[model samples]
Target chain A: MAQRTLLNQLIEALRCLPGVGPKSAQRIAFHLLERDREGGSRLARVMAEAMTRIGRCRRCRTLSEHELCGLCANPNRDPGLLCVVEQPSEIVAIEQATDYRGQYFVLGGRLSPLDGIGPEDLGLGLLEERLREGLVSEVILAISPTVEGSVTAQYIAECAAQGNVKVTRIAHGVPLGGELEYVDGGTLALAFTGRRAL
Target chain B: MAQRTLLNQLIEALRCLPGVGPKSAQRIAFHLLERDREGGSRLARVMAEAMTRIGRCRRCRTLSEHELCGLCANPNRDPGLLCVVEQPSEIVAIEQATDYRGQYFVLGGRLSPLDGIGPEDLGLGLLEERLREGLVSEVILAISPTVEGSVTAQYIAECAAQGNVKVTRIAHGVPLGGELEYVDGGTLALAFTGRRAL
Candidate 1:
């Protein structure tokens, strides 16, 4: 049987996602066709709306439907304490942990010289400008423990030092409830190096 | 920050796919937002249009945007040679293979007594009505080789025995280039049992 023209178009459009292959795109398209008309329409509407309305926060570069994101607009959040993360999803994870009560600065991505991703790509200039305002007292580097993340953290720390702001990287050690036997060598070494007096 | 009403609505709507969890749905929604506004709108339009127009063909039970599916409508297809399959996707697979040039009859599902699925649930009455029309020469059973598939095949074979038409089942054997070591026990057993003289 010939594929429906509209169905084919939908499948082609869904192929743009990072991990979605052609077969998966086709299946998703068929699923949308079989069910979820209301959901599909809603998704389309929101997709267009978000693209048109949402922009990076002026101070933090986090996605916001307004002038600033919710975290930046909150009066209860500590203006002097800032946690820096790599992406918006990291903000969700940190919020889920619920231990930090500070504002966030989303770097958008880490430094990758090989990939030509640099300070300009991550809005580091905006970050430097925010630090210059002298509202932030401490900048916590909550970025991933990758080499690229370390480079970005170091660069940010150097920039923050110029503004006389104390910069500290998040503690690295065995994760909570992680078995010592299962921990990798590098993490185990870091855990040993960062050990505290009881 | 409060989730935008439209964004949350879009995320909730995109969770209808078979394997898409909430996080993946959110990612897809955001991706559509970041790019592909026109494509997403087109997808929505197609989904709504296809759902409203596509329905089961009255004669063969295959998906049809018109009165009959392409297979049933094509004059080149042998109307007397009908291949029965478990789902609409199977028809697409067979069409892609281009090995079968006959019309099709979609069972919609197999007979699974344990799951409360029976002959009536699979549109067996319509199948019987078509078989009695006296124009059909051969009925090829192309359902899966599962226990349920066997039951359905047996039922169809019994019905064909009472009529003048010949009923045949697709071969169950090692696939081309398939190693014997990788073949499942059930398939190997079926292949052994169905072996023919040279």
Candidate 2:
């Protein structure tokens, strides 16, 4: 191990990022110190600011610098349609690929009895309150299509129906550009069951 | 686009790392804000400290928090055999792979005339001065095996000879665990030419 304490601490801290391991962390730490000091300094300042100032949006539970996130505050987006996701990152993925112009609700986590995460933990109470307002006509469940995810979605659908709102879920099938041979049986079955008239 | 200015700026700054593009940067930024605020804060502080305090070692030109790096300051390591490398990262690679206990000289970059790098830019004068001290009996070139790397190694070898010091280079061939079928022709040729008797 290198005898530099502070440098080692920096490397260890970088490993906390998703997919970053010891080797990648070391490379990033060295690159910042040796070649990209200005960029590193900027990253430091922005990260500090984002960490201290950013918080969950009151409406969606997504991390943002304000009480209401940009998507929640934008009037151009459809208030009649709401998309629900398990994590804030999922919101970005949908936004990048889809033309969905609706508001979002971040569940933050899915129902998992093993993990002790239930509707209350996901702030489903807040979701029910918003649905009861009668402004939203449809609720789209965009959570992952896992077993726990299905349970969570079903529970949410029941909650949405109580408010007289139509409930739907995002489709699960063989991914675009994927070969049928490599697609899992469960996904193929879902694709067959959800086939649309062409 | 996420319209939170501070969050977006954090993502942009994270893209400065090697192998990190827009998507990875965004994921990292979101992960920090959403899941690991304590880790993110510590990362920011360490990055600021490293950016401000770390500098090139006065003796070896490697990154360090002091005038002399750990290797340079150690009294027990052999100063008679010096290893030369392109960057500070290479020092780590060599240290991890080999038990070579010797001093080092960091060229910081390879010789590439098209890239406007020359002997002066590489601090060849400093290397020459060290060799002229006459304590060193051998200088090992650990530069990469590329055209520019070869040119740089040859120039350093010539410079080392002026001080009556023996110059050698690390062997380049099929890697220890590489399959012969997958080895490239240029490397296979070098392997064939450099074969040794049992």
lDDT per residue for candidate 1 within B12-94, as digits (tens), equals 76777658888887787666655565566655655556656767788888766778777788899987898999887777788
- Which runs in model 1 stand beyond 4 Å of their true positions? A1-4, A30-54, A111-120, A145-151, A173-198, B3-10, B26-45, B112-121, B132-135, B158-163, B173-185
lDDT of 2 by residue, A26-135 (tens): 99988888788999988888888888998889998987888998899888999999999999888888998899999999998889989999788999999999999889
Cα-based lDDT for every prediction: 0.80, 0.89
Model 2: CA > 4 A from native: A196-198, B1-4
Assess the local accuracy of residue A147 in candidate 1 as a C-alpha lDDT between 0 and 100: 91
Worst window of 10 by summed lDDT in candidate 2 chain A: A1-10
True-contact fraction per candidate equals: 0.39, 0.73
Alpha carbon lDDT of residue B185, candidate 1?
91
Model 2 lDDT per residue over B75-112, tens place: 87899999999998888889888999999999989899
Q: How accurate is candidate 1 locally (lDDT)?
A: 0.80
lDDT of 1 by residue, A12-51 (tens): 7677654788889877766655556556655555555665
